[model samples]
Target: MNHEFMDALNEIVESKGIDKDILIDTIEQALLTAYKKNFGQAQNVEVEFNRESGDIKVYSTRQVVDESDYYDSFLEIELTEARKIDPAYEIGDIIRNEVTPRDFGRIAAQTAKQVVVQRLREAEREIVYNEFIEKESELVDGEISRATPNVVYVDLGRIEGIMTRNEKIAGEIYKEGQRIKVYVVEVRKTSKGPQIIVSRSHPGLVKRLFELEVPEIEQGIVQIKSIAREAGSRTKMAVKSIDEKIDPIGACVGQKGIRVKHIVDELGDEKIDIIKYSDDPAEFISEALSPSKVVKVEVNEEEKSALVVVPDYQLSLAIGKDGQNARLAAKLTNWKIDIKSESQYEEELANGTLYAKEEKIEEEIVEDFEADEAVDLEEVAEFEAEFAENEEIEE
Candidate 1:
């Protein structure tokens, strides 16, 4: 070891962001292990490094003992032999002896190199872990570097992020070097490094994109109440205004629909329905089912449910393709929605069974009451007949 070697270590510390002292300490430990392996494993050894010259020195320790009690000759030295080195040597006192191997410098250098490399790798892993843990649930842009059938690797500048197949949009495909925005769903610290889990299908991605594009949302003028997304297909969002002057829907849409247009483009032209949020469940449910005209809205406030009636011809439209529109509407309103056509609602009213739930309970109670009334009537008739017959017999 020499000053030149210490300079090289300083350069490594500057480039790798590892503390110089820690590296030196680690190298010392590695040299200690190599010394024991090459010399005597059972002997007590101490290793030290000179800070100025980077020179390593090794020592072997032995306990002083009386001549009669010394059985392990290497681990115990009789005081008679110890007194030659020092007159203060007494029984049970410890002593150190220089045992540095003549050719140990070359061995220590080779051993230190391997240990430093391993420690550098560990330090890098720790750095990556600390960097990404703070970004959980945040949005980031990354380029697709590689893809397997089950996972896609994205180069996020400093580290690679993983996107599983389930995290990807249903209908979208990716190629090498494709730039895309992803939501940081999770950050895991493993033996290798920070495993950043990115997603293109998380509903949060849509919300974050809106925040980036619309200043009103970030400023609290307009608040996004809810979002329901079927990635690669369509999404419905409900927004409301904290400030009365700000039209939440218009603010999100921007002038001539430019704001929403940018988001749609990011999602590969995926459709988005921006609707005004309402305090009233009926009004909100009605708005949530957009692009389909709702004739009337009747709500059961206690149940947080709504009965939506639309034009007879609009029933299919309200239901949408495979009932996606109504499903998304239900999610957006946070309510159970029962959509009906005008004709169907009228038929349910005439039949006296609109809400299947409450109607069943009402029918049960009515049946019990009618049954009691019939039983009383039968008993009264029997008593009246018996009283008349008894009067005739007495007469």
Candidate 2:
């Protein structure tokens, strides 16, 4: 039992990464507690332990007094008897006698067991906390173990973390036993344990994933200036290559579309538009709303607004389904955008109208006048026709 106890302590120290000396100190303290609980409240009782051999010793101290003062009291010990234990002991001198605690083995065993468990738990907690604290805002690989209604339990080898429903991207599906990467949103130490909060919808996840997958981004050859994503739907990122020879968009796409495809697959086939960044607002906005072929871009730099004119056929495409593309573009550039068809814009300008205002008013007035003139003309024409018919009948 003694050898087994020492082996167990050695294993705990190695696995839990706790110092051997610290564990020994903790064990000694626990033994003291157990001794106090079992033994009576005697003054100046001391406990010591030899960690190497697992040897324990307990003792108590008493003050020596003259035979006349010696009584049945706990402190009043006869000097003659005290001197035999310690020949140099005199009146008022203190003597320490070896004492054996009852059931010392059973009590010590229980106390050591508790201390080991507690120390192991504390060591595990410290290890987990340190492991994840530096990983905050980074990406980690995990596998889906189970999916509940409100959360996903992901197995990250040694630990399990939860990805809440709010952290999941819309239209992104998480399946059982699927290997995935998630963003470390938070690492909190709670009373229950270390709570690791992960996410799939965070924008930072996409950026970090790209950094991991794309060498250009990792090496600082390509800089990701801005990124805007409607998670699980579409993402617009503005990238600029520092080296003129390197094509930022092509580098991100990778050979045979391997790099970006991996990211897309991870994100559940979310559409990604990589636009070359431009310092000029007009050029950047034009490129951002790609495949739409903007006819013109009138930017109000002070208000940070842009009036974009596209062909009639490309209007819907430029604005996207339910205006998603245009909205994301505006959000990406931090500009309010108003997209218009080329014909619609030209028609307004030709008629000396600003934004369909004068044209609508003029059309309303013309319709009213035309209605009144039609009524007068119909009455006059009826009277003339009746007079002509009466003259023909009389003749």
Candidate 3:
């Protein structure tokens, strides 16, 4: 290595954020290994580097010992010979002799080049991994670089993120070079480098988009309680407000529906329903089945299930095509919902099944109470007539 090489090393240190000392130590180790392999491993040698000139040198070291104690000349030098080189040498002192071969510079050059390149690649991978691991479960924008049948690759600047078929929105077309937003689902460290798993179908993507568009949500005035998504079809989000003055649904919807419109456009026109969150499961389930008016909701808290009633005309809307609305509502509330229309509920009531038996028992109790009230009114009227006749006689 030379001064020009040192200049390049400085550039690597500055650009890659790798410590210069670490690189130097790594290169020195590599050079030592090369020397041992080419020369002899039996030699006790240490490699050193010149910081100023970037010169590398290998030194053969031996321990000085008395002639009586010296058994191996390779590892130990006699005190008389050590003293000839340096009179200050003691029996236990170490002596170093330069053993750098004439052609060793060429070998050192090749070894250092390989070591630096490999180290630089490793440092870059570490840098990318650390940078993206922090971004898991967050939103990022990238351009579509390419697509295969099973995967779509998004160029995320320094690294590429893979979106598997399962992570893609159904029926959505991805064109090369198209700018898109995605949610980071996972960051994994692999032998190749960091693998970023991104998704458009994840419900978190919708939540993040809302956070970006709605200031109220980001400011903590309005908070999203839950989200259920069908990706390319529809999404249901439940939101609540910490400040009573702020309407969470209104805040997410924005004035003139502009905030949600932007989000919808970004999502390829997927429909979004922003509903107010309620602690009451019945009320929440009713709100979750949006665009369909619910007549009543009966909840079984222990079972985490509910029976929902809507107008006969709204039955199809409540169930949606392939029961998507009802399915999303169930997912959003974490409840199993059975939706029935008014006519179907009445039929069930007539058959005395499901809630019908309870309804009939309640009716019988109401009738008994009404009969007792009627007899009480009759007896009071009879007493009033008797008092009138006595007052007439007194007059």
Q: Global lDDT of each model?
A: 0.90, 0.86, 0.93
Candidate with the larger lDDT of 1 and 2: 1
Better of 1 and 2 by TM-score: 1
lDDT of 3 by residue, 217-309 (tens): 899889999999998999999999999999888999889999999999998899999898999999999999998999999999987999999
Best by TM-score: 1
Better of 1 and 3 by TM-score: 1
Query: TM-score for model 2?
Result: 0.72
Cα deviation of 187, candidate 1, in Å: 1.5
lDDT of 1 by residue, 1-395 (tens): 88898888888889989988888888888899899888769557888888678898888889999888998877989999999999999999989888888999999889888988898889888888888888888899999999887899999988999999989888788899999899999999887778899999889999999999999999888999899999999999999898998889899999999999999999988899999988878888889999999999988888888889999999999999999999999988888988999999999889876777687898999899887754777788999999999999999
Q: Which stretches of candidate 1 lie over 4 Å from their true place?
A: 64-74, 78-81, 89-93, 295-306, 356-395
Model 2, CA-based lDDT: 0.86
Sorted on TM-score, best first, the list reads 1, 3, 2
